[model samples]
Target: MSLIEIILVGIGLSMDAVAVSMSNGMVYGTLPRRKWPLAPLFFGLFQGLMPLLGFFTGTLFAKYIDCYAELLILLILGFIGGKMIYDGFKGDKEKAEERVLSLKLIFFQAVATSIDAFAVGIGFCAINVNIFFASSLIAATTFILSSLSFCIGRKFGDLLGNKAEIFGGTILVILAIKAIL
Candidate 1:
């Protein structure tokens, strides 16, 4: 693919990561300034890594991975979304507000969001693109978009108040369902 096409592909791949980053911001409110990049970093890192891994994996196990990717994404996101929904409805505002962002959770989100990218990398095996360059572009795109989205989510969370978690959770569940379909 051409550079423009690669960049466009990166944008397409980053959407889910963007949404997850936004959800994190909404559910957790404004995080510490030092922790601001945590989600995006994981998102970008995994986003980049998965595709490279996929490219290397090639068609060897692409079919097998595809068979399981959707279910994995569904379970991971569904569980997290379910928990957020429960917390939102629990009527414990203090606990909700005090919720800390976990690295493990972010790791899961990154992997969940990047599964499609792995497939894309598999497709890359049939093309003439440079996997490293393409993965880097994809990672950069995810990082920039996710970073901006987190800020947007934080602002909206402030307005949405306690309902933000529910809204975020609903988005995630919808995304999970969408992934499977």
Candidate 2:
């Protein structure tokens, strides 16, 4: 993948974390200044780490799918993007609104949100790109976006809501189609 595409994928993958960060911000809206960055920091860390884990795991089978890499990329990206789009239309109403935060809770949220990045790691292998570069781009983009979302949500609470997911999802789908042509 090109550097630009990798960055876009990072942004796309980050949407989920961003949404959650925003929600979490609002949930923990009353926190002292010192604790504000924790959630997004954890989110960024997991978002970065999960893809690396996935890439290494996927690297184990890279030889097997090398010949079919292009198709595999399409399959993975399409599936992920479609899921994101479907999730977007569903809206945010179904999610629970609760206050209070803990490290365990943050960890749980980070892992849950970064699960998609894990799948994305698998796709990275299909493209035969340097895992480090791709994961770094994804991680950096996720960090910036997640941090912004957390602040926005913390201050504003559920403003953009699910639209962010749809945008992110669409970016993935577009990139997937681009890979094919």
Candidate 3:
């Protein structure tokens, strides 16, 4: 694929990651400055890594992965989104500033969001694209977009207060449904 095509593909693949990063921002509203990059980095790394893995795996597991990718994404994002909604309604009343997002959660989100990219990588093999360059572009796009979305969500979170979680959770659930559709 050409550079423009790869970049476009990167943007397309990064959408889910961006949405999840935004959700994380809202949910973890007062996350420390040092930790701000955590979500984006994890997301970018996974987004990049999955494609390379898929490229290397080639056609071996393509059918299996394609068959189940949507279902897996649904379950992962659904569970997390449901939890966020439940927490929002439960009114735990913990200060947003006191909350810290767990690495496990970030890891799951990253994987869940990058499954489609894996499929794209398999397609890349068919097209004889440069896997490294495409994956790197994808990673960079995800990082930049996700970072911006997170910052935007943080501002909205401050304005929305407890409602932020509910909104963010809804976004994830919707994205999950969109994936299935």
Best by TM-score: 1
Write down the worst ten-residue block by lDDT for model 3: 91-100
Clashing pairs in 3: none
Candidate 1 global TM-score: 0.98
Model 1: residues with Cα > 4 Å off, grouped in runs: none
On a 0 to 100 scale, what is the lDDT of residue 88 in model 1? 92
Ranking 1 against 2 by lDDT, winner: 1
lDDT per residue (tens digit) for residues 1-181 in model 2 = 7888888888887876776676556545556678877877887788888788878788675455445544655665566557657866776545322234678767765665676677788777677788887877777788788778767765563454446556645655665575467
TM-score list, all predictions: 0.98, 0.63, 0.96
Which model scores highest in lDDT?
A: 1
Query: Global lDDT for candidate 3?
Result: 0.90
Tell me the tens digit of each residue's lDDT in model 3 across 94-122: 65445568899999999999999999888
For residue 68, model 2's alpha carbon misses the true position, in angstroms, by 24
Expressed as tens digits, the lDDT of each residue in 1-181 for candidate 1 is: 8999989998999999999888888988657989989999999988888889999999999999999999999999999998998999996968875799899999999999999999999999999999999999999999999999999999988998889999999989989999789
Candidate ranking under TM-score, highest first, comes to 1, 3, 2
Q: RMSD in angstroms, candidate 2? A: 8.4
